[model samples]
Target: MTYRIEVDQEICVSSGRCVAEYPERFRFDDEEVAEGVPGAPPLPDDATLRLARACPSGALLVFDAQSGDEIDIFGT
Candidate 1:
């Protein structure tokens, strides 16, 4: 199953927790736009949830690519 991650720019506070936690799967640009795509090694794992849970601004989002089923790691 393919999956993706989207960050809410409005709520993201430039916290690099996700990046630090899941460097392979999560990334942020200078604009602090977090993105998640399928990849290998160091890819996002349950640890991503930890980062998401820790993010005070609540920006992390996980979605199943085929089903569009979403998990608000940060809790909407």
Candidate 2:
């Protein structure tokens, strides 16, 4: 299943990791916080998880697209 990714600006550190790694999917807002690009193609589940885990500030969040349930990347 496809996954949805979001950036929590409140938690975002503006490291630019997501913007650099996935320019088509993410971009920095006026305040320099990372945000997901609207209408961007969805990422696969594995890649989505990897992206969430790679966020240094834990700003990236992953969700089950169909279920709208948040995925706990750090959970067992």
lDDT of 2 by residue, 1-76 (tens): 6778899999999999889989999999999999989999987778788889999999998887899999898772
Which pairs clash inside model 2?
Answer: none
Q: 1-76, model 1: which lDDT tens digit per residue?
A: 4445567877787777777766776677767766654564433456555665777777766677679898755454
Off by over 4 Å in 2: none
Model 1 misses residue 70 by how many Å?
2.1
Each model's lDDT: 0.65, 0.89
**Per-candidate RMSD vs. true structure?**
3.8, 1.2
How many backbone clashes can be found in candidate 2?
0
Evaluate residue 55 in candidate 2 and report its C-alpha lDDT on the 0 to 100 scale.
Answer: 93
| Shift of residue 55 alpha carbon in model 2, Å | 0.3
Highest lDDT: which candidate? 2
Worst 10 residues of 2 by lDDT: 67-76
